[model samples]
Target chain A: MAFPPEHEIHRRRFGRNIGVAVTLALFIVLVFALTVVKVTRGDPMQAFDHSVRPELAAEEAE
Target chain B: MSDIRAYEQPGEAGFGDYVQLLKPRVMSLVVFTALVGLLVAPVSVHPVIAFASILFIALGAGASGALNMWWDADIDAVMRRTKSRPVPAGKVAAGEALAVGLALSGIAVVMLGLAANWLAAGLLAFTIFFYAVVYSMWLKRSTPQNIVIGGAAGAFPPMIGWACATGGISVESLLMFALIFMWTPPHFWALALFMKDDYSNAGVPMLTVTHGRKATRTHILVYTILLVPVAVGAAFTSIGGPIYLAASIALNGWFLIGAWRIWRRDEAMAEADGYATEKSVFRFSLSYLFLHFGAFLAEAALRPYGMGGW
Candidate 1:
């Protein structure tokens, strides 16, 4: 059909759907970027990795 | 025949309603405090990770906010300040808020773990639980001391942000947490003091409702006094320096004077003057917090040039 949705509610629903779609797409990008960062990071990044980092030490010493 | 349903209910919810269900105003503070926490830490985080972590942290805060709106819809409908909120105003269904809250809570916690660390994730999870279950569900309606304890839920984001950077909590993080924590009572009590009709009509046991207005004024004074130390003491930490110390002293001094003025006023005087002092203090408290955090940001920014921190 070549016509727009008949009602204002339908138009609103269309907009909401677009919002959800864009949000989902952004989330996917975020996940992918986080994966790349985690994989490419040379040193262990988390505190649980048992590696001693000075910044983490600042938590105690500061 | 195009037989698909256009909408589900008698009332329609725009995307904005769903966004409103997340309490965007509260989320802004969460994002700001969390950002300050992440940046002020002694360690550095990758920009992508930092951005993702802050986003998820804000989402976690928004999720908890949605849960609060869901549970408090009844009182929200009664209180004038909240009567126009999405769930209460019939723009969004309570069940939708519940679903969104629960789903976002899970997603945010898990995503933060992947993007940052398990400790930060765990802290985020606890903050959500604290806000949604402990504070919103349990403390808010039941106790006069609700704001005192419930404030911790709002206070956790900075510490969580710090954890995202350093992978753990620190005195600096704790002080940031404490600054908001102590600030909440007086800030809210000042609001409650002025919006006197809202809580009592809704049967919410706000300090003004349970304990008398005079007592709440006293409480405001006491908490503001206690808050000054925590805000000023942060200056001695790794994240703090001369700038933060100066900002805290001035802010705390003004805040104390406001609280003192609030304490000295009887309801008759307040009513005659339209609670002007209470209202001004309430407005000032927002700036008070923003400036304190801004000072922290300034210190962190200037640190590389041999000027910022102690």
Candidate 2:
């Protein structure tokens, strides 16, 4: 079978590239949002303390 | 110019070529080390934040790789080993690589700063700069000790990872850095021993090219000897434990034996056997890094059960 016309091929390639770039950009934005929530509200290091060394968590709690 | 033009066939660049520009092999190592660093740290991060932080750090690594490819395209075009890389092969344009690198660098840094702390983000930024600007542009062509000094760029991942979790550097993180740093010279020189011709043809001042195979052999053994203590010493750190100590001992023993074999072989013997010893050492070096880092991951996993660390 023959391929599509040159312009059609170009359009397809352009569309694919743009789609990937947009997906990646959106993912980065989501990560940024999650990160802000983690920093401001979540106990990022609390899990670490309780999980790695329970004594530290008890100390902090006391 | 003509050499670069040789690879410039009349075809449109593909997305895979753009991915190739990121040097996924190098990026994978960066990601793995950073993950180990984060996991083995004393503080725990939320799983989501951990995932995002690793992703951003990986992007930073890929960004540096793209920039290095853009800058090193000229040498890469001439080197047999690197001739098929996206930029050097003309599958991707240098300007395009620069744009991708800069864009990713900014995104990864800003997002990491938001997700983690400024210290981790700042270290990531410095790592990118050191690899792209300091190593690729300045050290690579200028010194035979390029891999020695440039090794610092690759050695920063675990430190950066630990910093992401704890927001500070510690003895544990520095030990991780030291393990990678001391491992670099021997690891790379083993490859150079087999691929000296590529460096010579590319006009890069590799130790094997400048110092000759004899001195390169000696240097490999010397660095390997120096690396042993650092590798063993890390087992005593907060991030280390019995499993890591056992793994480190076995791996270092194997590595030293390989280095000894490499040191004892002459040029004629190496060529006669097709550089078998050198090639084996080079292949082994890859596993060496993976296993050491894997041990750290194991220790981290064991810690939750109270079986890891001192």
Candidate 3:
């Protein structure tokens, strides 16, 4: 079947749709990067945050 | 012909309309403060995670903005300053805002947990709730103290950033939070002084509307007096250094002079000058906050060189 001609509503809203699409794509990339970083860094607490709570026994200090 | 007629409707919203619904200007403040909070922390966060956490924090802040617009659509439509907002201006529906707020809120909170930790996530959730429900729904229309309490919601971002890095709060985060909290009243009251009818017309119970212009001026002076110590005192914290101290003392002195000038003016004098003093002070309040946060960022940036902190 042939595609119907574009309507004004669709034309006006085209940018909105694309913006939302871009936002969702970025969200996905961010989440994937977060996952990779979390895995590679092991325990986030041990990797950072030692100075803030120095009283706690050092698990793995740099 | 009927379908064509239907399709010809004007005032249809663009993507920017939805962005306006999120209150991008306010979100920029949230993003900046949160980034400073993260960067200034003694704990180091991975770049990727820091970016994601700040992103979600900003999303959470935007969610609160959407919810505020949703709840305030009536008042927004009435206020000249807010009449052009997407919902009140008929570019978007209230239900759509509510939906966007809820969806983004849930996603942001949960994702913050995954990216950072539960502490940061919980703080984000609380900040959203404080702004959306506590301030927007409850306090905004009820009391003149609305902005004072509502300011806490805005103040939470830095603490959340600190939490994101350290998984806990500290004196430094608390001081940052306090700085914004104390500054909110005077900053907004100055705007209210010049905005005149925007709050009164909307029945928002802003200090100017509830007490009186004279009383509002006094309140501005009082809050500015209170804000000086917080702003200057932060210079003595771990995140503070010579740059922050110099900036804070100068900025706070200028801010104090602005407040005192506003306090000394009467309505007749203000009217004769068209609230010029109020408007200038309001403008300065923006820079006051940006520079204070910038000082925090500077101190953190200079720390590696042994120049940032004492």
DockQ of candidate 3 relative to the true structure:
0.51
lDDT of 3 by residue, B192-237 (tens): 9988888888878998887999999999999999999999999998
Candidate 1: where are CA atoms >4 Å away?
A1-5, A43-62, B1-10
- lDDT accuracy of residue B5 in candidate 2: 56
Best by DockQ: 3
Using lDDT, rank the candidates from best to worst.
1, 3, 2
Query: Per-residue CA lDDT of candidate 1, range B1-310, in tens?
Result: 3434534454688788899988899999999999999999999999999999999999999999999999999999999999999999998989999999999999999989988999999999999999999999999989999989999999999999999999998889999999999999999999999898999999989989888999999999999999998999999999899999999999999999999999999999999999999999999999999999999999999989988998
lDDT of 1: 0.93
Of 2 and 3, which scores higher on DockQ?
Answer: 3
RMSD (Å) per prediction = 5.4, 7.1, 5.3
Each model's lDDT: 0.93, 0.90, 0.92
